[model samples]
Target chain A: MVFKGAEMVIESLRKEKVDTIFAYPGGAVIPIFDVLFDADDINVVLTRHEQAAVHAADAYARTTGKTGVCIVTSGPGATNTVTGLATANFDSVPLVCISGQVPRNMIGNDAFQEADTVGITRPVTKHNYIVTKRENLGKTLREAFHIASTGRPGPVVVDIPKDILYQPLEETYPEDVNLQGYTSPGKGHAGQLKRAVTAVNDAKKPLFFAGGGINVGDSSKIFRNIIEKTGIPVVTSLMGIGALETKNPLNLGMIGMHGTYAANLAVSECDLLFGIGVRFDDRVTMNLEKFAPLAKIIHLDIDPSAIARNVPVEIPIVGDAKIVLEELYPLLDKKDRPAWHKTIKEWKDEAICINAYEGFNAKEDDSSYLMPYQVISTVNRTFPDAIVTTEVGQNQMWTALFWNFKEPRTLITSGGLGTMGYGFPAAIGAAIACKDRRVVAIAGDGSFQMNLQELATAVKCRLPIVIVILNNGYLGMVRQWQQMFNGGRYSSTHLNDRIKADKEDKVSPDGSPDFVKLADAYGAEGCRVRSKSELEDALKKAAALTDVPIIIDCLIEPEANVWPMVSPGAGLDEMVFCIEKEEE
Target chain B: MNHVISLLVENNAGVLARISGLLSGRGYNVESFSSGPTLDPDITRITLVCRGDDTIIDQIKKQLNRLIEVIKVSDLTNKHTIDRQFALLKLLVQPGNRGEIIQLAEVFAAKVMDVGSDTMILELTGSEKKIEDLVQLLDGNIVEIARSGLVSIERGRKHAAVSQK
Candidate 1:
């Protein structure tokens, strides 16, 4: 059958089972949008900004096990997706970004709205292709989707020139793809499996350190079997939260800088650390020198470079996590280390009794305002298993430090790039992917304003995502840095002028926007919570709503900073906890 | 440890740069590399010799396998692999020694691709050692010599797929 490139793209997407696509249209991508108008099978969401479109697609990929797709125009639209692509690359999320490029003849002569989208995204994507011929569209799309979804999945870009999209060709799709050089190892090597099993069985105080790979590989059941049979406690990375149930005796909470005290203590004291599919990111190992100080590490990962890149491993096993775990499980000798389990329980109880929020007694009479921690902990208490997404800065750090994520894939935050304006759209995508569950986005006022227009997208999609804005009036994280290190010289940190005035009039009566009204205007429910009681009540109500998206504007202290942060140049051991007041 | 890998890939733009960039981005060390079109007009052969331990080499092979343009990657370090290199030597042939040079070329089965008034370019295809032997024989009388890097294949009937299996 003869078909145009745009029609072929839409048809190929349908064949690939892609039902929903987040996109933003423009001059270059108009032809594809025109074809999309008649494409009834696919649901295309129009986002306010191109970045939100990519981020929403990324979140969709993370929630569902499908390859998320996003379409955008060239130049600025393609550039905006850079941050989202980087985020997905770092987190290894599967995404296929199809960008409309300027016509082939107009490329490279400084054509209007022409940018080297493939060159720009090369560093952040698993692979990318620029289709110069119309006949290659079907093959390229199939390959892009396959590479994006398979073996350590990541974002892939296909830059389709406008002229190529308009060209006509006889549609021929390859029934099967046989890549000669590309071989993803599907099973574990028997030799490496033997070495790993021997290392695990020989260690007395072994701990399982799992990462997002567990969820991606679908090896949670195998992980549980290994832990139960071996009777070793497991400590997860942020992405590894849901590999095993948090309440299980064998499962310790997340381990790292802001991890539970028990998890950190176990990591520090354990004799053997069995790291599975987890990269030793800086956040997980606060001080690489002192991290797992007493533990002999055994690293198992599919990516061979990651095995010995960060932490030196005693035994490195390069294989798929699921296959490796399955092979390693049977070799372990059945034994119960009751005394070690008891020690872990004691540490957990001590952490809960001492460092937990319930132990903090705020001065009731002061009533200055609610702290960021209080708001985060309240949300954590209300919805324990809700999928939480956060924008960068103080809000992101606070969410990391305060929220208790029980399952893997539930805590979807931009850890590698830490991009601002990621929360709202990502939450929308997550909500759309897992419609049965609630998706909450915790973003700062400054971060929220960057992509606040995505609220219209959320409203149109009826995603039912609850957004919690930590409205601190100013750029809280930067302001705190200035106050602490920059001699209190706050330059461009204040958002007073930015928020107070409307875009049309420079000097409006009220400079600040009523976010509640904005949310209502977008057709979603909105609420303003000032006091602690109001904040708690609003959160409870937002969780109960099942019909539409909800936004809660939370008023917080402007100068509040994320604590227990190691000052940039300082040693990891020299973390600055809450400031201590001097005795008069 | 250093590994010599010979890859067969489709002749396409930016494929070499992609392979090199992937190596450098991951901090892997590439020592020597060369690529040229093979007998097939559509296929190109690339020989890359890299330095690193077994882990690094394994990763390089795996990552190379992921590239769409690459068809096959073989580590010629295995004892069963047969490798060869080709070189052409241009000799300044004196009238008094022309017959002797032609006799030497015939003895080695080297074909004379180009003949000038004073020079004869002999094309010799064989293992790296054989080329080195020919170069040493005509070192003093040779005007110039160009050598193609190593291209390898396993000696046994088994191919990469069969070996891997």
Candidate 2:
């Protein structure tokens, strides 16, 4: 049977078993939108903008293990997705982004709203295709999904011109894909696995350094078992949160720039560093020379290029983390290192006094203003089973440090790109994927505006996401950096520009659009709190919502900073504790 | 150190941009680049001459190999290989200097492609060194020069076939 190009896409999506799509429509995609209007089986959540659409899809795929799908129209709609695609690319999240284009004849003529969608997105996507003819649409889509979901998954773009979408096609979606140059090995070598086992047996101080790849490989349960059986202490990169339970005695908190004292020190002193599905990013290994200097590193990753990109390794195994851990488990010897455990405990104890989270005593602090740590940890302590997402900045670090993520895929943040406006829309996507659990978007005032418009979509879908904006009147992170590293010249870091330097109070005026009123305009619940007690009251009210999202704006201390910060290029050990340490 | 890395990539649009963009982003100096279709319609072979030490070159290879389009990457720096380049020179053909230019072209095995009343275009296909010598021999008389970057092939049976892995 013959079908239009738009119908072909719908049919292909059905074959791929995609139940939900985050989309934004435009002139070039009117036909597709028309079809979608009547297709009750396919749930399309039209977001506020194209960026949110892609981010929502990205988060959906990251948490659900299915390929996330996004559809955007031509020109600006297509360009807005670049940041989301790059974010997905760096982390290897699977996304299939379909973009609308101008008519085939109008391409390259610079017609109205005609931008080169394929060219602009080429570098960001794993692969992209431009469909000039209708006959090849089925096969192209089949290949697009195959490439996106397999072999170290990543985002792919398919650009279809407006005219092509209306034309008739002869074939239905294909059942098979042709990818001659791609392969993903699932098994580790016997010889290499044995060498790793021997290194594990020979070392007195051994450590396990995990990353997001473990979660992507679906081996977290097996990972925890190996850690328990071997009795080795574990440290994870930011992406590796929930690698082991937060309360587990062996799971050292996140490692790197904002990593805990115990994790950094253990890595520095270990004789063996067993790396699983991790590429040592610069943030994780600030001074590459001093990182794991005394250790014989054993690295395992599915991507061959990631094996030896940064640090030297004695044994590099290229295979799936799930399969490799399953194989390595049988060969491992059960041994305990009590001396190493004692040393790590000391490091963990020292870290608590330095980390700012430990310094917060809600009732003891001055009652004039609210503390961010108090609010973040209060929510974490209250909602033990909820999923949390954070924007890039002080809010992200505070959540990562204080949330105590005890389960996998519970904490989502933009780690590689550190994009400011990631939290709100990503929370929407996660909420859609896991309807039974509450997904909270915790963002700072500076980062919240990046995609604040997404509030309307939350109300439309009744996502019931709890959004907490820690309004600190300044870009707190940059301000802290300027104070420490740049001679206290707080230039361009203030979000509240109305604050006069001569004013005695030196406090900026309230944020415009007043978040509470803004949320009210969208028909969603908005609550403002100025004290620690008010915040607690707001939390209780927000948690019981079933039909709408709650936006809670809390007035917070402007100068509060994330502590145990390693200076940009300094080694992991040289962390400068914040003001609480100075008071001592 | 200078190294010539050969890659077999899927013949698709934007594959070239992906490779060049990465090299540029990583600050690797691409001294020369050549790419063209292979006997297989679905694949293209790319040869890049980059300037870097061992660590930098290895980084370039690893990053390039990560691209889905790239099937195989072979470093031909130390391997036995054959390389050739071609250049087209548009030169001022004054009456007195015509014979001197002809003599230099004959020595370099350059073909005389186009000739007008006052201009001549000479095509030379040889090693890069030989092309450099001919250009130096006609330094003042040359008006325009378009040179194809270095293209190479392994000496014997060492081919960069698409590995199944």
Candidate 3:
């Protein structure tokens, strides 16, 4: 059947099995919104900010493995999508951002609310298009979805000028699309498979460094098989968490800065490194020159540019992780390496000991604010396999360091873009996708405000997500930078007085809404915790609830900062550890 | 080892980025790449040259096939392919040697696209090896060469026809 562009978009999404969409309305995108209004099949959430809409969509994409779609208006509306687009792109989350542009005639004339959205989002998106004609909308939408979900999945944008969205066109969605310039590597190269096998056989201390690509490619089975057969110890990047069970004997835990001492130590001493579907981001390879210095690197990724982009590789394989691993599986020899496995096991034991935190002693009756680490560890213990999403800042680092993730896609956070306020919406989305699994959002007070409005969306959708807010009364990350670089001159970091004032009345007389009151207003449960016991009880109760989202406002110390953090513009090896002793 | 790969793909948004992301993500080094629309609006031709051992190239081919948009992938390095590259060289020519340089250009069938008092620009299109040989012949007199990445076609066959279902 022939359909309008807006109707076609909804229809296409329906075909893709999408049920909900998060979006904000605007002038240029009224047509699509109008269509959505009449449509009862797909639910469109009205977000407070355009950015939040896209972020929610990204969260949905990550959790569902289906392309998350967001619709926004022209100019400012489209520009607002940039942050979410960049976040999705960096994290390799599949998203389709449909933006409304000024009519084609007014595009370059600098008309009202006109912006070069295609140009602005070029670097941030996997691919983008400006639909000047209505006829191309169906093909473009179909193609956009395909591109977003394909190899090394990422965000794709389609900029539809207002006129095209409004245009009445007899358009038929192509059952199949053919593109000429794009070729995704599907199978493992036979030669590379042979060489990888040879390298594995020849190596004495071979290690597998895994990354997020493994999850995106659904290579967990293949990865487990390869490791099981080859007896290669595996360490994951922060994004790579959950690829293998952390409890697995062969799993060495996450490696890099803030990584387990065992993982870093093992990588440093290995003779051969087989990196799969993971970029050697600076976070993983602290010192490029010294990283795996003793190892002969065998890099396998679908992207060719990643080969030798950071750490030089002796052999590079450009292919999908799932396919490549499958091909290499049978080629491998089943040789037992008990000595090497034992060595890794010993290192893991030491790591567990080093990372252990001693509980608060009764003798030391210090009534200081709750430690971030204690809060994170307690939550991890309570929800051992829960999908944990984090807002960027000290809380994100705390979650990464404390939560031992044992499944891929279980720890969904904006790693590459480091976007704040991503936790609540992402958690909500994850809760929706994995209905059987519990999802928790660990966010700092400052970061939480960025998308606090999403609490309403969660409540509306009846998504049972537990939000643990590390309310440090300041923008923790920026405040820490100010403390370190700005001579301890706290400019705008103070939030304690304001937080208390807002709590008293729950909303300002000037109509500014308090978060706790807002959560209650939206029919969701809310609690404020001051002690460790209170926080733990709130989390346990929240986890038990499956009808509505819960918000726990945690009163934490503003001075607390994530330790072992590598300061920007500083050497990777140089890290600022948390202070254990008072300054002299 | 260097390998030449010819891929037929659907001309769609993000296809190029997907290809580039896949290559770069895997740690494979792309030596050169060129892509353009074919005679059909739905199809496009992409020729990429990458450096790695045989196993790596094989992996690249396998991965390229997995991409939904990709119709076919052939490792042209060992195959009979009509490989061509375009290079435009601007040269600093003295009045005395201008005739000699023109004679050399005629021998190679290179066209003089631009001429100036002290500079002459020659446009040449040929196989990579042929272009390299031509560059060596005029090495001392050449000022600079701007190359468009290599583009190739399978010899005596079209990729679309073979892959069409």
Give the number of the best model, judged by TM-score. 2
> Per-prediction DockQ scores?
0.31, 0.55, 0.13
Ten-residue stretch with the least lDDT total in model 1 chain A: A499-508
**What lDDT tens digits, residue by residue, belong to model 3 across residues A299-342?**
99887756776677888898999888888888887787777878
Ranking by lDDT: 2, 1, 3
Q: Between prediction 1 and prediction 3, which has the larger lDDT? A: 1
Candidates' interface RMSDs, in order? 2.8, 1.9, 7.1
Reference-based lDDT, each prediction: 0.80, 0.86, 0.79
lDDT tens digits by residue: candidate 1, A504-532? 32323334467888888889898877567
**Candidate 1 clashes between residue pairs 3 or more apart in a chain or in different chains:** A181-B65, A182-B65, A242-A407, A242-A408, A500-A511, A500-A512, A501-A511
lDDT score for residue A259 of model 1: 64
**lDDT at B45, model 1:** 81
Candidate with top lDDT is 2
Lowest lDDT 10-mer window, candidate 3 chain A? Answer: A357-366
User: Candidate 1 docking: what grade?
Assistant: acceptable
